[model samples]
Target: MTLPLNPQRVSVDSISKIKELSGENIKACMQCGTCTVACPMAEEMDFFPRKVMHFSQFGMLSRMEDINSYWKCASCHSCSVRCPRGIDIAKVMESLRLLVLRTNKNYIEPSQIPKEKLKEYPGIMMVAGFRKLTS
Candidate 1:
Protein backbone atom coordinates (compact mmCIF):
# COMPACT_ATOMS: atom_id res chain seq x y z
CA MET A 1 0.00 0.00 0.00
CA THR A 2 1.22 3.48 -0.85
CA LEU A 3 1.45 5.82 2.09
CA PRO A 4 0.23 9.36 1.73
CA LEU A 5 2.68 12.13 2.32
CA ASN A 6 1.60 14.50 5.06
CA PRO A 7 2.99 18.01 4.93
CA GLN A 8 4.84 19.06 8.06
CA ARG A 9 3.38 21.98 9.98
CA VAL A 10 5.44 25.08 10.76
CA SER A 11 6.23 25.93 14.35
CA VAL A 12 6.65 29.61 15.17
CA ASP A 13 8.37 28.62 18.38
CA SER A 14 10.99 26.70 16.44
CA ILE A 15 11.67 29.73 14.27
CA SER A 16 11.94 31.96 17.29
CA LYS A 17 14.26 29.53 19.04
CA ILE A 18 16.56 29.40 16.01
CA LYS A 19 16.68 33.20 15.81
CA GLU A 20 17.32 33.43 19.51
CA LEU A 21 20.14 30.92 19.41
CA SER A 22 21.79 31.97 16.15
CA GLY A 23 21.20 35.74 16.50
CA GLU A 24 20.84 35.83 12.73
CA ASN A 25 17.95 36.81 10.48
CA ILE A 26 17.02 33.66 8.64
CA LYS A 27 14.43 35.48 6.54
CA ALA A 28 17.25 37.53 5.06
CA CYS A 29 18.14 34.56 2.88
CA MET A 30 16.99 35.24 -0.70
CA GLN A 31 17.44 31.71 -2.07
CA CYS A 32 20.41 32.93 -4.07
CA GLY A 33 22.14 29.51 -3.73
CA THR A 34 25.43 31.18 -2.81
CA CYS A 35 25.60 29.28 0.47
CA THR A 36 24.94 25.98 -1.29
CA VAL A 37 27.57 26.71 -3.93
CA ALA A 38 30.11 27.71 -1.34
CA CYS A 39 29.54 24.69 0.92
CA PRO A 40 32.22 22.04 0.54
CA MET A 41 29.99 19.50 2.29
CA ALA A 42 26.91 20.21 0.18
CA GLU A 43 27.51 17.09 -1.87
CA GLU A 44 27.24 15.02 1.30
CA MET A 45 24.09 16.74 2.57
CA ASP A 46 20.59 15.43 1.95
CA PHE A 47 19.43 19.04 1.53
CA PHE A 48 21.53 21.95 0.32
CA PRO A 49 22.24 24.91 2.58
CA ARG A 50 19.86 27.15 0.64
CA LYS A 51 17.02 24.66 1.08
CA VAL A 52 17.83 24.30 4.77
CA MET A 53 17.54 28.06 5.11
CA HIS A 54 14.31 27.99 3.16
CA PHE A 55 12.82 25.35 5.45
CA SER A 56 14.17 27.20 8.48
CA GLN A 57 12.63 30.47 7.36
CA PHE A 58 9.28 28.73 7.28
CA GLY A 59 9.90 26.94 10.58
CA MET A 60 9.46 23.50 9.07
CA LEU A 61 11.03 21.65 11.94
CA SER A 62 9.38 18.31 11.23
CA ARG A 63 10.67 18.36 7.70
CA MET A 64 14.13 19.06 9.03
CA GLU A 65 14.05 16.36 11.71
CA ASP A 66 15.27 13.51 9.57
CA ILE A 67 17.61 15.44 7.28
CA ASN A 68 21.39 15.14 7.52
CA SER A 69 22.10 18.56 6.03
CA TYR A 70 22.67 20.38 9.29
CA TRP A 71 24.62 17.46 10.78
CA LYS A 72 26.77 17.39 7.67
CA CYS A 73 27.61 21.06 8.07
CA ALA A 74 31.27 21.58 8.85
CA SER A 75 30.76 25.02 10.42
CA CYS A 76 33.58 26.19 8.17
CA HIS A 77 31.87 29.58 7.63
CA SER A 78 32.29 29.37 3.88
CA CYS A 79 28.57 29.93 3.40
CA SER A 80 28.56 32.79 5.87
CA VAL A 81 31.42 34.48 4.05
CA ARG A 82 29.68 34.25 0.66
CA CYS A 83 26.11 35.16 1.66
CA PRO A 84 24.91 38.32 -0.01
CA ARG A 85 22.60 39.24 2.86
CA GLY A 86 25.23 38.62 5.53
CA ILE A 87 23.16 35.85 7.06
CA ASP A 88 25.43 33.41 8.83
CA ILE A 89 24.13 30.13 7.38
CA ALA A 90 26.55 28.25 9.57
CA LYS A 91 24.88 29.68 12.65
CA VAL A 92 21.50 28.59 11.37
CA MET A 93 22.85 25.09 10.91
CA GLU A 94 24.25 25.20 14.41
CA SER A 95 20.86 26.30 15.73
CA LEU A 96 19.20 23.32 14.08
CA ARG A 97 21.69 21.03 15.76
CA LEU A 98 21.05 22.73 19.08
CA LEU A 99 17.31 22.25 18.72
CA VAL A 100 17.78 18.52 18.19
CA LEU A 101 20.21 18.24 21.08
CA ARG A 102 17.90 20.11 23.43
CA THR A 103 15.48 17.18 23.25
CA ASN A 104 18.15 14.87 24.76
CA LYS A 105 18.39 12.87 21.58
CA ASN A 106 21.85 12.21 20.23
CA TYR A 107 22.45 11.92 16.53
CA ILE A 108 25.04 9.26 17.19
CA GLU A 109 25.71 7.26 20.32
CA PRO A 110 29.35 7.48 21.27
CA SER A 111 29.19 4.12 22.99
CA GLN A 112 27.82 2.41 19.90
CA ILE A 113 30.77 3.41 17.75
CA PRO A 114 33.35 0.69 17.20
CA LYS A 115 36.62 1.16 19.02
CA GLU A 116 38.62 0.55 15.84
CA LYS A 117 36.69 3.23 13.95
CA LEU A 118 37.19 5.69 16.75
CA LYS A 119 40.92 5.03 16.67
CA GLU A 120 40.98 5.44 12.88
CA TYR A 121 39.26 8.82 12.95
CA PRO A 122 41.24 11.93 13.80
CA GLY A 123 40.83 13.32 17.29
CA ILE A 124 39.79 16.75 16.00
CA MET A 125 37.04 15.16 13.88
CA MET A 126 35.79 13.09 16.82
CA VAL A 127 35.79 16.14 19.05
CA ALA A 128 33.84 18.19 16.52
CA GLY A 129 31.35 15.37 15.92
CA PHE A 130 30.76 14.89 19.63
CA ARG A 131 30.19 18.60 20.10
CA LYS A 132 27.70 18.72 17.25
CA LEU A 133 25.96 15.34 17.55
CA THR A 134 25.83 14.80 21.28
CA SER A 135 23.74 16.64 23.79
Candidate 2:
Protein backbone atom coordinates (compact mmCIF):
# COMPACT_ATOMS: atom_id res chain seq x y z
CA MET A 1 0.00 0.00 0.00
CA THR A 2 1.37 3.41 -0.97
CA LEU A 3 1.01 6.10 1.65
CA PRO A 4 0.61 9.70 0.56
CA LEU A 5 3.48 11.89 1.59
CA ASN A 6 2.83 14.95 3.72
CA PRO A 7 5.93 16.95 4.71
CA GLN A 8 4.11 18.15 7.80
CA ARG A 9 3.84 14.59 9.05
CA VAL A 10 7.57 13.84 8.97
CA SER A 11 9.27 13.13 12.27
CA VAL A 12 12.82 14.45 12.47
CA ASP A 13 13.40 12.63 15.74
CA SER A 14 12.60 9.29 14.18
CA ILE A 15 15.02 9.96 11.32
CA SER A 16 17.74 10.94 13.76
CA LYS A 17 17.14 7.81 15.81
CA ILE A 18 17.44 5.61 12.74
CA LYS A 19 20.70 7.31 11.77
CA GLU A 20 22.05 7.03 15.31
CA LEU A 21 21.16 3.35 15.54
CA SER A 22 22.28 2.33 12.09
CA GLY A 23 25.27 4.67 11.75
CA GLU A 24 24.37 4.96 8.06
CA ASN A 25 23.44 8.04 6.10
CA ILE A 26 19.94 7.13 5.01
CA LYS A 27 19.70 10.15 2.75
CA ALA A 28 22.61 8.81 0.73
CA CYS A 29 20.34 6.20 -0.79
CA MET A 30 19.59 7.18 -4.41
CA GLN A 31 16.56 4.92 -4.87
CA CYS A 32 18.66 2.87 -7.26
CA GLY A 33 16.87 -0.41 -6.48
CA THR A 34 20.25 -2.17 -6.22
CA CYS A 35 19.55 -3.05 -2.59
CA THR A 36 16.12 -4.37 -3.52
CA VAL A 37 17.64 -6.53 -6.24
CA ALA A 38 20.28 -7.91 -3.87
CA CYS A 39 17.97 -8.66 -0.98
CA PRO A 40 17.23 -12.38 -0.79
CA MET A 41 14.03 -11.81 1.17
CA ALA A 42 12.75 -9.04 -1.14
CA GLU A 43 10.08 -11.29 -2.65
CA GLU A 44 8.61 -11.99 0.79
CA MET A 45 8.55 -8.38 1.95
CA ASP A 46 5.38 -6.26 1.72
CA PHE A 47 7.56 -3.21 1.06
CA PHE A 48 10.81 -4.01 -0.69
CA PRO A 49 14.17 -2.73 0.57
CA ARG A 50 14.28 0.24 -1.81
CA LYS A 51 10.84 1.43 -0.77
CA VAL A 52 11.79 0.99 2.87
CA MET A 53 14.80 3.20 2.33
CA HIS A 54 12.68 5.74 0.50
CA PHE A 55 10.21 5.99 3.36
CA SER A 56 13.05 6.12 5.86
CA GLN A 57 14.76 8.98 4.03
CA PHE A 58 11.57 11.01 4.23
CA GLY A 59 11.13 10.20 7.93
CA MET A 60 7.93 8.32 7.25
CA LEU A 61 8.08 6.08 10.31
CA SER A 62 4.34 5.55 10.30
CA ARG A 63 4.53 4.13 6.79
CA MET A 64 7.14 1.65 7.95
CA GLU A 65 5.42 0.63 11.19
CA ASP A 66 3.06 -1.97 9.71
CA ILE A 67 5.33 -3.25 6.96
CA ASN A 68 7.08 -6.63 7.04
CA SER A 69 10.11 -5.47 5.04
CA TYR A 70 12.37 -4.91 8.02
CA TRP A 71 11.15 -8.08 9.77
CA LYS A 72 11.73 -10.19 6.66
CA CYS A 73 15.25 -8.88 6.09
CA ALA A 74 17.71 -11.76 6.49
CA SER A 75 20.60 -9.41 7.37
CA CYS A 76 22.82 -11.31 4.96
CA HIS A 77 24.50 -8.00 3.95
CA SER A 78 24.00 -8.64 0.26
CA CYS A 79 22.36 -5.23 -0.08
CA SER A 80 25.17 -3.54 1.78
CA VAL A 81 27.81 -5.23 -0.29
CA ARG A 82 26.14 -4.13 -3.51
CA CYS A 83 25.14 -0.61 -2.52
CA PRO A 84 26.96 1.96 -4.62
CA ARG A 85 26.74 4.50 -1.80
CA GLY A 86 28.12 1.92 0.68
CA ILE A 87 25.12 2.09 3.00
CA ASP A 88 24.78 -0.91 5.33
CA ILE A 89 21.16 -1.73 4.60
CA ALA A 90 21.08 -4.65 7.00
CA LYS A 91 22.08 -2.35 9.86
CA VAL A 92 19.25 -0.02 8.82
CA MET A 93 16.84 -2.93 8.98
CA GLU A 94 18.17 -3.83 12.42
CA SER A 95 17.73 -0.22 13.48
CA LEU A 96 14.08 -0.33 12.39
CA ARG A 97 13.57 -3.51 14.45
CA LEU A 98 15.23 -1.84 17.40
CA LEU A 99 12.90 1.13 17.17
CA VAL A 100 9.85 -1.13 17.53
CA LEU A 101 11.50 -3.20 20.24
CA ARG A 102 12.32 -0.09 22.27
CA THR A 103 8.58 0.55 22.55
CA ASN A 104 8.32 -2.70 24.63
CA LYS A 105 6.10 -4.33 22.05
CA ASN A 106 7.19 -7.79 20.98
CA TYR A 107 6.59 -9.31 17.57
CA ILE A 108 6.09 -12.64 19.29
CA GLU A 109 5.28 -13.45 22.89
CA PRO A 110 6.96 -16.59 24.19
CA SER A 111 4.36 -17.17 26.87
CA GLN A 112 1.62 -17.24 24.28
CA ILE A 113 3.13 -20.26 22.52
CA PRO A 114 1.43 -23.57 23.16
CA LYS A 115 3.39 -26.09 25.23
CA GLU A 116 2.95 -28.75 22.56
CA LYS A 117 4.27 -26.46 19.82
CA LEU A 118 7.17 -25.35 21.98
CA LYS A 119 8.16 -28.93 22.57
CA GLU A 120 7.99 -29.64 18.81
CA TYR A 121 10.20 -26.65 17.94
CA PRO A 122 13.96 -27.01 17.91
CA GLY A 123 15.93 -25.46 20.76
CA ILE A 124 18.08 -23.32 18.47
CA MET A 125 15.06 -22.16 16.49
CA MET A 126 13.34 -21.03 19.68
CA VAL A 127 16.42 -19.19 20.81
CA ALA A 128 16.77 -17.45 17.47
CA GLY A 129 13.10 -16.57 17.44
CA PHE A 130 13.28 -15.09 20.91
CA ARG A 131 16.39 -13.12 20.02
CA LYS A 132 14.81 -11.72 16.88
CA LEU A 133 11.16 -11.23 17.89
CA THR A 134 11.38 -10.28 21.54
CA SER A 135 12.33 -6.98 23.10
Candidates' C-alpha lDDT: 0.86, 0.86
Clash statistics: count for each candidate = 0, 0
4-117, model 1: which lDDT tens digit per residue? 122257877777888998999998889999999999999999999999999889888777868899888999999999999999999999988887788688888999999999
Runs of candidate 2 exceeding 4 Å displacement: 1-8
Give a tens-digit lDDT track for model 2, residues 3-43.
Answer: 22242478887788889999999999999999999989999
Q: What is candidate 1's local distance difference test score? A: 0.86
Quote the positional error of residue 57 for candidate 2 in Å: 1.0
